[model samples]
Target: MLLQIKRLSSSYGRVRALNGVELNIEEGELVALVGANGAGKSTLMRAISGVQPTNGGGIWFDGADITKVSASKRVRLGISQVPEGRQVFSEMTVEDNLLLGAFTRPRLEIDEDIEKNYVLFPVLKERREQLAGTLSGGEQQMLAIGRALMARPKLMLLDEPSMGLSPLLVDQTFQTIQKLAESGMTIFLVEQNAYVALSIATRGYVMEGGRTVLEGTGQELLDDERVKKAYLGV
Candidate 1:
């Protein structure tokens, strides 16, 4: 497995946000976890990425136990997360924001990786010198994905990539995500839009009330009557 979590648990002060969740992703596969707000989807992402502390269980990446790794060190281990908000550096130029993603990489390899991002998001290339704050919401979301890619991660985590977008932009973003998956990127996506998310997923797990309630291939979940009524709005 490229990433694995077994019986993982986490908390926000006294309130438990995660409860013994188990998930896994193999190399070059796009796996998705779908749920509504406060379903612990983001918490699970944070725990795997090492931002949220794990109170129990284990996280292993590339066959090594990383349950106790520091957040900064986890980045070096090839996990990059594009958080829910398009948290671009509003004060910095687009290219500058992207450059930050490769901070741990050798200086010589930085430009080459950045050029790759430009190809992935041409709008960002055109706005390379523009302050990120000036871009529209959809543009900022693109920049955020580009910045995360600049790291050249082995595994990428996308949290609610389509949130708050117009239907058209959301469609465009998921298309880009599909392109990435087609290119063999290992992605773990957490999304509220179950129908769209599962449509792009190789496999999916349905999450509710801090635990995984169902798991299957994308098509299987989409075809399920329970899933349709609860999440797909059938």
Candidate 2:
């Protein structure tokens, strides 16, 4: 497995957010995690990325235990997270924001990486000198994904890529995600839109009340009666 979580639990002070969550992602696999708002999906993503503190259980990446790893170190170890919100550096130019993602890399290789981002997100190249804050929501989302790719991560954690997008932009964003997965990037996606998320997933898990309540191939979850009733609006 490229990533593994065993009984992982996290908390926000007195409130428990994750309850023994277990999941795995294999190399080059596109795994989707779907749940409703407040279902602890984002917390689980944070825990896996080593930003949120864990009270119990473990996280293993590429066969190494990294539950105690710092967030920066996790990034260096090839785990990159594109958080729930776009969270772009509003004051910085588009090129500068992309440069920041490669902070851990050698300076000599940074420019090459930046060019790669431009190729992947041509709009960012066009707006290289523009401040990130001025871009439309969809453009910012593209920039966010481009920034994360600059890290050259082995596993990409995407939280709510479709949040706040127009229906047309949502469709475009997911098309990009599907292409990324098809090109062999391993991804762990957390999303509230069950239908969109599951439709592109190789496999999927359902989170409920701070726990993973179901796991199956994408089609399996889509075809499941309970999933249909509760999430698919069948």
Candidate 3:
């Protein structure tokens, strides 16, 4: 396994957010965690990324235990997260925001990585000198993903890449994720759009009220009657 979460549990004061959630993802696999609001999907991503502290659990990545690792160190260890909101610096240029993602690396590598990101996101290339705050919602989301990629991560955690977008933009975002997966990027996606998510994911888990209630191949989940009734609305 490239990533594993064993009996993960977390709480926000008296509110228990995650209840012994368990999950696993293989290298280069695209996995999705789908759930409704307040299902603890974002909390799970935060725990894996080492931002939100866990009460009790183990997070193993690339065969090493990172449960207690610092968030910055985790990024250096090849774990990067594109947070739920497209948290781009509005005043900063697109290139500058991307450069921030490579802060842990040497200065020389940062330039190289920025060029690579530009190639991956041609729109960003055109807006390289433009302020990130000026981009459209979908474009900003793309920039967020691009910024995360700048870190050269072995495992990328994404929180709701499709949130707050038009139908057309949503389709484009899913296509971009599929392209990334085809290029051998390992991804753990937290999304509310179950249908689109499962379509691109290799495997998936369903969360309800801070617990993982279902696990299976993406196709299996898509075909599941329960999943259809609740999430897919089929």
Off by over 4 Å in 2: none
- Overall local distance difference test of candidate 1: 0.91
Across 6-35, the per-residue lDDT of candidate 1 in tens digits comes to 988889999888888988899989999998
What does candidate 3's lDDT look like per residue over 1-234, in tens digits?
A: 999899999999989999999899999899999989999999999988888989988899899999999999999999989999878988999989999988788888888888888888899999999999999999999999999998999999989998899999999988988999999999999999999999889999999988899999999999999999999999
Q: Mind giving the per-residue lDDT tens digits that candidate 2 earns over 1-234?
A: 999999988889989999989898999999999988898999998888888999999999999999999999999999988898989998999999999988888899899999888888899999999999999999999999988888989999999999999999999999999999998999999988899999999999999988899999999999999999989899
Off by over 4 Å in 1: none
**Model 3: colliding residue pairs:** none
Ordering by TM-score:
2, 1, 3
Residue 74, candidate 2: Cα error in Å is 0.3
Q: List lDDT for all candidates, in order.
A: 0.91, 0.92, 0.92
Q: Which residue pairs does candidate 1 place in steric collision?
A: none
Model 2, global lDDT: 0.92
In terms of lDDT, the poorest run of 10 residues in model 1 is 45-54
